[model samples]
Target: MEHHRSISDVLIIGSGIAGCVSALTMAEEGVHCTVITAGERLSYGNSELAQGGIVFHAENDEPEILEKDIMTAGWNHNYAKAVRQLCALGPDVLQELFIDKLHIPFNQRKPGDWFLTREGGHSLPRILYCHDHTGRNIMEALSKAVSEHPNITVLTKRTAIDLLTTHHHSSHMDFKYSLANSCVGAYVLNEHTAEVETLLSRYTVLATGGIGQVYLHTTNTPGSIGSGIAMAHRAGARLLNCEYVQFHPTALYAGKRGGQRFLVSEAVRGEGAVLVDSCGDAFMKRYDDRADLAPRDIVTRAIMDVMLKTGDDCVYLDAARNIKKDIVKRFPTISERCRNISVDITSEPIPVVPAAHYFCGGVLADLNGRTTLERLYAVGECSCTGVHGANRLASTSLLEGLVWGVTSGRDIARRISKTEPMSEKLRDSIRDWVNAGDEHNEDPALINQDWATIRNTMWNYVGISRSAGRLHRAFSDMRTLAKNLQDFYKNTPISKPLVDLFHGCQTAYVITLSAMRNRQSKGCHFRAD
Candidate 1:
């Protein structure tokens, strides 16, 4: 196979907020960066689908107070150091990067005063939003800046096939004898050209977002199938808390509306929306004292229990009677989407169900975004910094991504300056991606069936509630499916769908195995047995 090589100071395998932020931070310091996305559009990802808001410092808000809220939501399972770093430096980073540098027009009460809103798991109104389209607005600004920046190169429709580790990809046998493994770059598949390119860099960052798409129902973008996690796992990066998959309590229930569901922002509940039965009877108060304000895990489980007991397909989110603000104006995006499905948020209740939303577990990384592997960093949803712990706090996802993006970018810039470039011999030792079988052997029908089996198995046996029996069955089934997919993957031509299925299968197996090993019912990893 012929090889095409591209070099950069940094290679970021995502185009979301974290990727964009990291690129911008490094580029400003004269470091060249290459940002790639599997999606056709640079702005398409889980970050673009975010609606609730990003956490900020509210009036009289202290780092300790925010830390307490986060710990409470995470059930005291959070890494105290990571939580401390985020709570202390997050606001400053937000101000410097988003406000001062990017000039993102976040909503304001008046000049000099920002419009802060609350969300589930937050103690106060400490979230900044751009109407109900916070992620969209933030991405628009970041993507534009990244595209125009002279030091940053944006590549779309490029899927990362695997991380290029010295121990794994090097043609030299001596590299295998080295005590430590270092990531040199990645083998990326260029969709437009149908060719795999060797993308080499001094440093590599994985900002690839959530794993929600692995489930049957999710509030994530289509490409979020745990590709980054699978790639990192293949490279032997340490993974933490792989069982904690957070399910959003209120995804609009439009039956058979593809895999991606329209998320009813938690800000709606923060604005006074209440979860009720079909008969308009409020039920959250029965589950927790905080009722609608409870952490996502509690709320998601409560909704599931309600559904199981009542034998209903979905529950109702009554925003019409509770929220005093004009629903249309305050949540225009929600209103518009709801309207498309013949549901009016201003006058009626929204049919809602819990859907796979966020993954609290991922490749282990530190506060500076350094993973266990040398020269490889992970930020955003893909990296488990131990900040979110067993469950994520509402509105903290964006803040976590932002804080780490800036820190990782700055750290990489500093490290790269002192680090020597890869030697010509070492660089040449990295082998090109090879095709193992006939390109025409890939069957789309078989791939789609495999995906369906994985999704259905995950949703049924490993979803909101789980048991020893269910998890055991899930592990058995996924283990078999993963092996089959691996075999199919080796012999099939590398297409985007084929690659996604392979990654998805591997990720599903990881999550299932993790779920089976942990017997405790904590946060999102609720083991009924």
Candidate 2:
């Protein structure tokens, strides 16, 4: 095994909004940061797929109102401090970063007034969008800024294998005797050369996004397989709300049960699209008085119940009949995507189903994004700040990522200036990655099969609804699968698929275990028995 080493003031794993914001924020303070991602492009994550907009301050809106909406949506399980921080700072950060700094072309009603839209859990229309392609537009501008920044280095096609912690990766026995476990950096695999590089940094941030890919059907990109959570958990970081996985209520259902599902943005429902059964009977009113505007958990269960009762695999979103706005103009991307499948949003209903979308729980972190482990931080969907609690309000994902990204970045920069880098002797004591298997023995077929088993197990047993029997069976199956994957990982050469599969399996075990431990139903972690 060959070894290459690089050092930076800050190391950011995952190039989504959170990672980019962290990098840019620190870089502005003269900190040289390295941002890495597993995908070929920096824009290949959930942030880029965010069709809805981010939260902003609407007219006559108070921070307390937004806080109440968030707490209500989260079933009062939210961390009040985190919620308050988001409501207080989110709009200002959005204005400073996206509006004033980047000058992103968000939709505008006039020369001075911006166009705002509503989502499922909001009290008013407070989301700022760029038509329906808000994320694409935001990522495009943000990635460009990151690429051009002299203090930031963007490395694509780099997969983070694991966190480098003193308690685990240190070669010195005496260092393990210390009370604290500190992370120095990570072992990152360069996909182009298949070489593991030791990326040492004064501060390491895990913004690796969500765990949607762990389920059979999801709106997340293929890369979102809980790598960050798996790495943090292995490094002894505390995880919170692992059982609360939020399923989006309306994913475009094309009669498929697996792979990435096209998301029917909740903003569509906010625009008046109603969920109806095959017989065109509106059913959300039966479950919640808010009907189409119910929170994601309520909407998802309603859709599921309707599907089960009607013997239908999917329901329909009738935007054509309800939304008075020009459907094609308001949602050009959705219209085009539906057009490809011979369903025009302007004329009829679009087929939809529930799919895994977001993870409200993750590696426990604070408002500053600092994890339990020293010198390591987590932001974005990968970190549980306790803001989302049991379920996330629509469009808040992007805002949380942005706000925490800036906060974490500023916190790291402020601290890094006074702290010295790791000593040479201590750095030298960290060992490099060593491969134990024949590189030729790696089989794509086996990796694919393992991933399939993981996704199917999560979706079937621990999905939108759960029972004790289902959770027990899931735990048993995942336990066996975890052991098998551990053995396979030890014997197989490193690859992107292999690393993702290993992480996915570990994450599945964590989620299932968390579900089994909790007896009461709260938000998204509903138990049938």
Candidate 3:
């Protein structure tokens, strides 16, 4: 098979907030980076779909208050150090990189003053936003800056197949895992060309986003099938907390079959929008003291309880009755999305249901974003820094990405300056990818059928609530599916859907196994039995 080769200081496997922020940071440090993305566009991940905002410490907000809110939201399972770092560095990172440098027009109260918005589990309005589409605006600014950077290269529609560790090099001792030795780079598949490329880099950062697509319903992008997590796992990187999947309590209940659904921002609740039953009765107070303002896990469970008791498919988010301000002006994206679905947010209650939204657990990385593997780092939703612990607080996802992305970029820049580049001989030793079969013998229908099975199995058994029986069953089923997918992956030629399916199966296996081991009902992993 024909192939391509490239060398860089760093190879980033995503192009969302983490990838863009890190690329911009490295470019400023005069480091060369090549960003490979599965999506053709820059803001294709969950970052752009973020309708709420990014969390930050405002002038009146104290570290202790921020820490308390985060800990409470995470059910006290948060890593104190990581949470402290996020709270401390988040404001500075946003101010310096986003506001001062990139000039993202975040909604401001006045000139040079940030317009802070409140979200669930926050003691105060410490979340900064750009009107409603905070992520979109932030992404636009970062994408422009990254595109103009001469030292950074953005390769769209390139899917990462696996990490290139000592196992891939003939001269070096073959190690089973990435943690056993240093990571040189990765095997990248060019989607347009149908060719594999050996991308060798001094450092590799896995900024690929979440694993939300594992479930039947999610608020994540279609490409968010845990490809990075799967690749890192195949490289033997330590994945922690895969079981703690955060279900956003208010994804617009479009249908069970939709790949991605509109997220009714938690800010809607923060603005006094309340969850109601079909009978139009406010129901949050019966679940938690915080009511509509409780942490996401609590709200999701509460909604689930209501659904179970009422035998309803979904609950309603009534914003018109509570929100004093014009709903359309506040949430233009949401209003338009609702209008598209023939629901008027200004007058009627929008139907919503809990769906898999974020992965709190991922490849274990330190505050510096260094993974268990040497010369390899992870950031954003793909990396579990333990900041979110068992559950993520609303609006903190974007903050985590910014803080960790910059930290990882700086760490890589410092390390790469000290370490020598890969030798020509070592780089050449990484061989081309060879396909075992020439025929496209695999049935797409079978693949899709198995994919749907994986989703339904996860949604029913390993969803917001789990038991020993359900988890064990999920684990067994996923293991069998994984084996079959692995067999197919070994034989089939490289395709985006096939690659996504292969990674999704691997990811589902990891999460199911993790969920089965952790018995306690903490945060999102609630056990009914």
Per residue, candidate 2 scores C-alpha lDDT tens digits across 3-72 of 8998888899999999999999999998999999888888999999999899998999999999999999
Model 3 lDDT tens row, 256-375: 555678899998888889899999999999988989999999999999999999999999999999899888998998899889989999899999999999999999999899999888
Lowest summed lDDT over 10 consecutive residues: which window, candidate 1? 435-444
Candidate 3 structure, TM-score to reference: 0.97
Better of 1 and 2 by lDDT: 2
Model 2 / residue 267 / CA error / Å: 1.0
Q: Give each model's whole-structure lDDT.
A: 0.92, 0.92, 0.88
Q: In terms of lDDT, which candidate is stronger, 1 or 3?
A: 1
**On residues 160-240, what C-alpha lDDT tens digit does candidate 1 reach at each position?**
999999999888878988999999999999988999999998899999999998899999998899998999999999999
Candidate 2 accuracy as TM-score: 0.99
Instruction: Give me the runs in candidate 3 sitting further than 4 Å from their true place.
Output: 168-180
In model 2, where do residues sit more than 4 Å from their true spots?
none
